[model samples]
Target: MKNIRNFCIIAHIDHGKSTLADRLLDYTGSVTDREKQDQLLDSMDLERERGITIKSHAIQMDFEYKGEKFILNLIDTPGHVDFSYEVSRSIAACEGALLIVDAAQSIQAQTISNLYLALENDLEIIPVLNKVDLPSANPEEVTDDIVELLGCAPEDVIHASGKTGFGVDNILAAVIERIPAPVGNVDEPLQALVFDSVYNPFRGVETYFRVINGEIKKGQKIKFVATDKSYFADEVGTLKLNQVIKQSVKAGDVGYLITGIKDAREVKVGDTITDSANPTINPIDGFEDVKPMVFAGIYPVDTDEFEELRSSMEKLQLNDASLVFAPESSAALGFGFRCGFLGMLHMEIIQERLEREFNMTVITTVPNVSYYAFTRKDPDTPVIVNNPTDLPDPSSIDRVEEPYIKATIITKSDFVGNVMSLCIEKRGQITNQTYLTPERVELSFDMPLAEIVFDFYDRLKTVSKGYASFDYTPIGMRTSKLVRVDILLNAQPVDALSALIHADNAVHIGKKMCEKLKELIPRQQFDIPIQAAIGAKIISRETTKALRKDVTAKCYGGDISRKRKLLEKQKKGKKRMRQVGNVEVPQEAFMAVLKLND
Candidate 1:
């Protein structure tokens, strides 16, 4: 335990956390030159292509410093705010973190976020200034920012170029010298924290954990404290960049525990693992499971693929336990799943993986955050409303509350005016704003998560000319005037098309949706009425005209009365058709309403 170092790299997105991991691997000779790949720890293809770590990954590396052999368990965490829960869990398992800052960009929102999380966990932070080899590199200035922000010594800060492998040796030496070793009793009962898990085709569910005390072996009986399920350890191994099966994993070590459990739900993340015969006294603190914040309905393009879609979602859930789903049926779109996500990016990555990885065509409804509706009958019990269709009548509700977030944006001072305007437009209330540096400012706002979840980030980037970075954490709910706007097709309400909207922009938003639907929906044999309404009151309406045909041309050579009779009969038939015809809204129309711009 004295020779082991358990630490993770923390940084903002595109700040070279992964690049540093690659360099460390190269310097330690963990993987030969022929076997090493760029961003070697990032397992997902989506991660490499997008240049961001979506999932937190851990690998055991062997490093030698001054003829002393040491074991380094390096956990690479995702920098996105959406995966902050996962980040926190990873930090909890480690004793120290390498806080990476861009030499040119200095400190950003996520960098501060990671710093706070590390502080909360009471982990030692090693500030490393990365990308010092770039033309715009300003290590001295960034080092100063770190010193002022974190109050660390000037000499304590390390200057390194993760891109060029400069100061790589110094960074490793600091880990061995400054970072404390794990302090766990080797003779105590087995106690491990399951931080992450993965589902395998042949091995079933594989649980990755950090051994806090005692030891675990292949034949030992282990129990999951949360699930209360006991099983014989089928396999035990340590992660050596890849899995290396071993008979036993000792205290203060990170390894996988395979119990032949096929269901990932049974062996959930954040659950504790202990010896079944002599279990640990208590589970580790801060083991709360992650809850979904935003929701959207996911439907298959073809009705026959509903079962296939369900199966694929189940398999995906085995890997992503945060993704919540249940059977949902839409009148216009058929059977689907109403899925919940940690945030918008998590929702998008899941959608992309489903379509690309599983080879499935699926349509997703507009994303919406959860709301709390206090009903007149049950005013004390606020009903959690995830779907717009679940909301009661406006007269029967006391008040509605939507989720709000404390959003922080760090950008150049030149774009503060533009950013303030955009935030105000999104119903953002400026809580605080201060200049972090002479040229860069930190803008804080208490705003609804719904607003930031939508195109707010893209707009901020555009207004700031890509100079701004954003981060947000939910700050509970706020009371507001919100209403459910229902889109009606041919006078029938579509459950899936309903949206909970703020009352101020309800009318304009409804009218815009009606217009976009009118353009996307195909013309039928009869006129299709597209209307947006709140309860029984219609706010906006648009009509798709019926296909015109020259039915009277066949009677062109006949008598006038014959043509008149034919026209009269056609008019009556049209009236009857309008009464009984059902509007067939194409799949594209629903998607158009989601992406429609006002």
Candidate 2:
């Protein structure tokens, strides 16, 4: 245990965390020069393409320095704010963290958020300044920022360039000298925390765990403390580049345990694994279920493919326990599932993966955040609603509460005015603002999470010219005068097109939605009226004129009376068609109004 070092990397996105990991892997010979690619720990194709770590991955490295052998357990965590829960679990699993900050871009939004998390976890933090080789790098300024933020001496900060090999070896030496080794009671009954897991078709579920007490071996009967499900361990081993089977995984070690249980549902993150016969007296703390914050509906483009979509979702969920979904049907869209995700990015990644990996075509509705609705009769028992359709009638509701977030945005001084205006437009209240440096400023706001969950992030990136970074934490709930708006096609309500919006902008949004639907929906034989309404009152309307048959064509060169008679007959026919004809709305027509203000 004295030779074992457990530490993970935390950084802002695009801050060279993955690059540093790769450099360390190559330096230790854990990954051969020929075997490594950029962002080696980020194995998913989406992750590689986006250049971000979406999932947390762990590996064991054997390093020799000064004639001493050290086992370094490196856990690479996601840098995006949306995956903070995942980051928290990774931090909890380790005894120390390698906090990497880009020298050119010192202490962005996620940098502060993750630093606080590492401090809260009581992990020894090794501050490293990356990207020192860049022409714009300011190592000294960033070192000062770290010293001020972490209260560590300027000399204690390690400087390294991820792209180049400079200071790479020195950082490893620092980890050995600074980070503490894992300490646990080996004689205590087995108590391991399941931090992560992946599903295998042949082996059932492959679980990654950190042993806190005792040891686990092949053939031992194990039980998950949360589910109380027991399975005999078929194999237990450490991850060396890949799965390397071993007879036993001792306490203070990070390893994988294969139970030969084909069902992935039995194994979950935050669950405790203990010996069945000699169970531990208490389960380790800090295990939290990943509750999804964003909700969206996913339906098959072809109704016949509903079953196929279900199978794809089930298979996908086996690997991603954070994803939540249940069967739901829509009048406009057939049978489908309403899915919950950690955030909008997570929702998009899951949908993309389902299409790319499973070869499934799905139609995803606009994402929404959960809201609380209180009925006048049951004001104390506020109802939780994930969809606008589930909300109670406006008359029966006493008050509606929406989720709020405390957001921290780091941007250049030039764009502070623009960022402030954007936040105000999203109904944000400025709580505080601080100048991090002469050129960079951190703007803080208390805003509705519903507002930020939509196009706020994209708009921030656009208005700031990609120089801004953002991180937010939920700040409970606040009352809001929000109402649900419904879109109607020829007086027939389209339930799938309903959206919840603030009462102040309902008229403006209704007008734009009605007009946009006019452009998207094809004209029918009979005139169709596109309308937006709050309850029974129409707020906005647009007309799609019916096609004219040119009934007077046959009357050419004939008398004027003949032309008049033909026109009158055509008018009567059109009137009769309008009385009975139904609008045939295509799929794109429904998706056209997804983002009204985009």
Candidate 3:
């Protein structure tokens, strides 16, 4: 255990965290000949599809230096700000971090943010300059920048091209030399911190943790500090912490536990796993109360597929304990769940997975920030609402508070004005600004979490010509004029199509919703009026033309069989839709309204 070095790779988005992780695995011979992928740490299909590290993945390796065996446990963390909390928790489990910086791109806002977090945790920092093989590589300049930024000696910098495998051996050596060995007493009772977890259909919940004290083994009875429940550990799984050998993981080690606990609700990520005999005096921190800022209702396209949707979400939650859900029933839309997530990115990931992994189509309402409001008469009491239909009487509302975030944008100086103007238009208040480099500036602002969530990231890149990088952290709540925008089909309200928006932007928001409805919802069997209304006044309206008749007028005896089959298919298709009076609306009608731009 003294030879083990546990570290995590931190960097901004596209700074090559996953690529560097792959290079480390390749250099240490951890990746087998048959299993070499470009970015191996991004194991999820969605991660690969999105080209982002949405989740933290860990792998172990063995490297030999000066005739001594060194074990390296590396965790790959998400670069996006939406998952910053996950990144923080990942850093909590590591003793060191490989701060990967693009030689050409220099340091980004997230680089500084994550670096500060790593420093706060007192983790040893090994600065690595990646992408040195690129044409714009400036190793010397970036090295100097890092030295000044991190206050580390220039000689300590590790220059490496993870893409070309250049200088990878030196990076590995630096890990062994610079990262301190795990320090703890093995004689103490077993205690481990559950930093991350994944759901395996075969093994149920596979929890990854760092053994903080004592020893853990297969068949040992363990107790969770959060749940106060005792369970027998079925087995302890070993990662490739050097060579492939089965051994009981003890204190100062990193590994996984596979208990036959199918219910993910029982085991949370940040829970303490300890020996039932003598729980450690300082138990691991219980799961942090991660509040889901974005609230959306998810429903299947076909009502019959509701069961499948629930099953998929349950399975997904087994791996992601951060997601929150509650069964919600709508008079017009049947049964669905009001799902809450950390932010928009989290919601998108879950939506994409359900469509791709479970082979089910789903409709999602527009993402909304939960609000707390009180009516004039009920000033002392507050109401929390996600759906507009649940909004308390406007007359009763005394004040409303919305969640806001402190956002930091790092971009080339050329985009500073554009970003400032864009943020100002979105109700953002400039807080602070700093020059990261002669050509780059870091701008901080207090913006509503809802403002920057949906397309702000892509818009930032577009306006800045892909030179802008950003990160954000929550900064509590603030007073705002938030209201519910109701969507009407024909003359009745469609609960699923309702959205919460700032009152000032309701008219513009309604127009956008109408446009998105045209793109998201298919034509109905009858002309459906998609109208956004405030109170009884309609702000925006568009009609979707009725779908053409599927059954032909003439049917021969032989063709009658085919016509019957066609009729049966049409009937089954109609079964997937809900009829509200004369209009035949698909589940997507509600979902399309959520994505106004799409």
Q: What would the TM-scores of all predictions be?
A: 0.94, 0.94, 0.89
Q: Where does candidate 1 stray beyond 4 Å?
A: 300-311, 327-329, 553-588
Give candidate 3 regions above 4 Å deviation: 241-245, 304-308, 515-527, 544-582, 586-598
lDDT of 3 at 5: 89
lDDT of 2: 0.87
List, residue by residue over 1-598, the lDDT tens digit for candidate 1: 8999999999998899999999999998888878889989998889989988988889898888888899999999889877777788889889999999999899999999999999988898999999988999888888989999899999998889877899999999999998889989889999998888887878888889999999999999999998999999999999987799999988889999788887656876778899999999987764556778789999998999998998788778766767899998887778999999988789889999898778998988878888999988988889988889888878899999999989999999999999999999999999999998889999999998877766777788899998899998779988999999999988888887898889998998899999999988888777888999998999999999988766788875857999889878888888898889887666676566556653
- Among residues 3 or more apart in sequence or in different chains, the pairs in candidate 3 whose N, CA or C atoms overlap within 3 Å are 366-594, 374-398, 375-396, 375-397, 376-396
Report the Cα lDDT for residue 450, model 1: 75
- Candidate 2 local lDDT, 1-598, one digit each (tens): 8889999999998899888899999889998767888888888999999988888889999999899999999999899877887788888899999999999989889989999999988999999999998999998888999999999999888989888878888888888889888889888999999888887777777889999999999999999998898889999999888888999998889999888876556777888899999999899885566677788899998899988888778767756667889999888778999999888788888989999988988888767889999999999888998888999989999999999989999999999999999999999999999998889898999998888777788899999999999998888989999999998988888878888899998898889988888988888877899999999999999999988788877666957998899888888988898878778777666556555666
**How many clashes does each candidate structure show, in the order listed?**
0, 1, 5
Given candidate 2, what's the lDDT at residue 238?
Answer: 98
Minimal lDDT window, size 10, model 2: 587-596
Evaluate model 3: give its lDDT: 0.81
Provide the global lDDT of candidate 1 against the true structure. 0.87
